[model samples]
Target: MTVLATPHPTGHPGYSETLPREPESAAVARRLVRTALAAWGLEEHIDDAMVVITELVSNAVEYGRLASIRVVVTRPAKHRVRLGVVDRSRTVPMMRTDSNGDRIRGRGLVLVDSLTERWGTDLHQWGKQVWGELKCEPPR
Candidate 1:
C-alpha cells in the first residue's frame, strides 16, 4: 500500500493511498480519511467523508476487479472536502433508484446523493474515477 501525505502548495493539504482489491481495504480507506481530516483540522467532516469513501472503495473492490484501488481525500477550499476513488474498471456507476425501500443492496449512490453537496464520475482511458464533495463547516 503506497500512501501519499504530501503538503499541497495551496496549503489545504492532500492525502492518497492505494489499497488492494480486498474487503479489508474499505476499512483502511476510512482510517486514512480520518487521519487526513484530523491533520487538516477538519474532523467535523469525518463521518460524512468516511461514508462516501467507504461506498466508493467498496464499489471499486467489488466491481473493479483490479489489483489495487486508489483513494484520495483533499480539501480544495476552506469549506469543502472531496473524496475520490480510482479503479481499473471502466464501468461507470449508476444511481439505482428502484431500491423498493427494503432492499439490502443498491442504495450506495442514493445515500451519496442525499449526503454529498455534489458527486459524479469521470471516465478515462485507463478506468474511471468517482468523486463526492462535502460542503462542511469547521468545528466550533
Candidate 2:
C-alpha cells in the first residue's frame, strides 16, 4: 500500500491504491477511479476517468515489468483532476498512427489524448508513471 500525500489547493486529500499486475487490474482501477471521483463530487468526469484508467492499466499490465501497479487520482486545484498510473517499466508509451488504415490496437492513448486537457509521463527509479489531467466543471 503506497500512499501519496498530494496537497490540493483546496486542501482535499487525493485517492491512491496499488494492485497486482494482472489482466483484471484494469477493471479494479476503473472502479477505484469512479468511486474516488464520485466521492470528490466529480461525477461529470467519471466516464473520461474510467476510460483513461482502463488504458493506463492495460498498458501497464501488458508492457510493464513489475509485480504491482499504483494509481493516484488527485485534484491539484479546482475544476481539474489528475490521474496517474505507475508501473515498473521505463519504456515510454508511444501513440501510434496508422496512415493506411485504422489499427485495432494503439488507440488507447489516442482516446486519452482526445479526452484529457493534457497528458504526459514521468520516469522513476523503478519504472514510469503515465498521467493525464482533465479540466471539468462540477455541477452546482
Overall lDDT per candidate, in order of appearance: 0.83, 0.82
Model 1 Cα RMSD, 1 decimal: 2.1
Q: For residues 1-140, what per-residue lDDT tens digits would candidate 1 score against the true structure?
A: 66677564223238888888887998999999898788767788898888899888878888885799888888787778888999988999988888468777777888888889999999989999899998877777
TM-score of 1: 0.89
**Clash total of candidate 1:** 0
Off by over 4 Å in 2: 1-13, 99-103
Ten contiguous residues minimizing lDDT sum, candidate 2: 4-13
Error at 96, model 1, angstroms: 0.9
Which segments of candidate 1 are over 4 A away from where they belong?
8-13, 100-102
Can you write out model 2's per-residue Cα lDDT over 32-130, one digit (the tens) per residue? 778777766789889999999888888888888868988888887788888889998999998766552655777788888988999999998889999
Per-prediction TM-score, please?
Answer: 0.89, 0.87
- How badly does each model clash, as a count of residue pairs? 0, 0
Q: Which ten residues in a row have the lowest lDDT in candidate 1?
A: 4-13
